[model samples]
Target: MSLLLETLTTGDRITFICTGLLGLGVLALLSRPKVVAAEDGVTVTNLTTTRRLDWAQIVRVNLRSGDAWVHLDLSDGTSLPAMGIQPGIARDRAIADARALRALVEAHGTGHSAT
Candidate 1:
């Protein structure tokens, strides 16, 4: 760390420090997407934004064979992409997560719930 700092000018050093801080600030946000289910609702943390949805608001959880991630069919007639249940590196886990979320939606949702 000292060797890297020693080679840079004062302005460059400041810039480097600022960049490092900025990079680390959003590191976790970029590294992992999450879907958390609680008694009240589900919280989905995507790449840059997070959304909270009540169980009744989610009509279905769709994760087709060729899909990259699960998608929620909402009561408001919009689809929300859930990147947390992606089938890229962990296909079995993703499928299991998708099934679990789907089961929750089916059990709790009342408005147009389906398989």
Candidate 2:
């Protein structure tokens, strides 16, 4: 390792480090969680788990102030984070998306609450 480090110029070392960091950023972005709402249900895909909940199973959809993302309250007494409606960068768009999701729940879900 010492010999390899010695062989690399300062520019080469910086380039290697930057490349590694870029790779890690890309991997993190790719692995970020996602949520999709369909006619039948909502699908949430996180790093280690993927869950699908029917319209009836979701009790509420909320995107409160300062929240990083939208959250879904489920009938099973649990809440799931929805990464698709992130709160930074395109905040207006995220809010719009969250509203649209809430509308979907209200229209399709039986007696579900949304906010």
Candidate 3:
């Protein structure tokens, strides 16, 4: 409002603008996550990073009932969080996506499920 703008100092207005921009950037980043399945591998784009993984590298795909999103178990003995398959509001879609990704990992890589 005009009153609020009039009361704020120039530095305060600049700081407020920067903070709003940063918040928008964070929200954009949160919505930027996705999973891409290619011929050779899968690409997981999380909040702050993107990882390209070979089919063989992914040992398992886990999306349990209580889980908020899919987690990929890699052959390197590490688990990577895949936010692309989150089951928050779209639970069924997320489940299907997890299953499809799992099938791709199995058919293209080692048909091995977590033991």
What is the clash tally of candidate 3?
Answer: 0
lDDT of 1 by residue, 87-113 (tens): 986998998888888777777776443
Model 3, 2-105: lDDT tens digits are: 99889999999899999999999999998988999999999999999999999999999998888878999999999998998889969989988988998899
Pairs clashing within candidate 1: none
Q: Give every collision pair in model 3.
A: none
Residue 56 of candidate 3: its Cα lDDT?
A: 96
- Candidates in descending TM-score order: 3, 1, 2
Cα RMSD of all models vs. native, in order, equals 2.7, 5.0, 1.9
Candidate 2 ranges with C-alpha deviation above 4 Å:
1-6, 9-22, 25-31
Worst 10 residues of 2 by lDDT: 106-115
lDDT of 2 at 58: 80
Better of 1 and 2 by lDDT: 1
Error of 3 at 85 (Å): 0.4
RMSD of 2: 5.0
Cα misplacement distance, residue 105 of candidate 3 (Å): 0.8
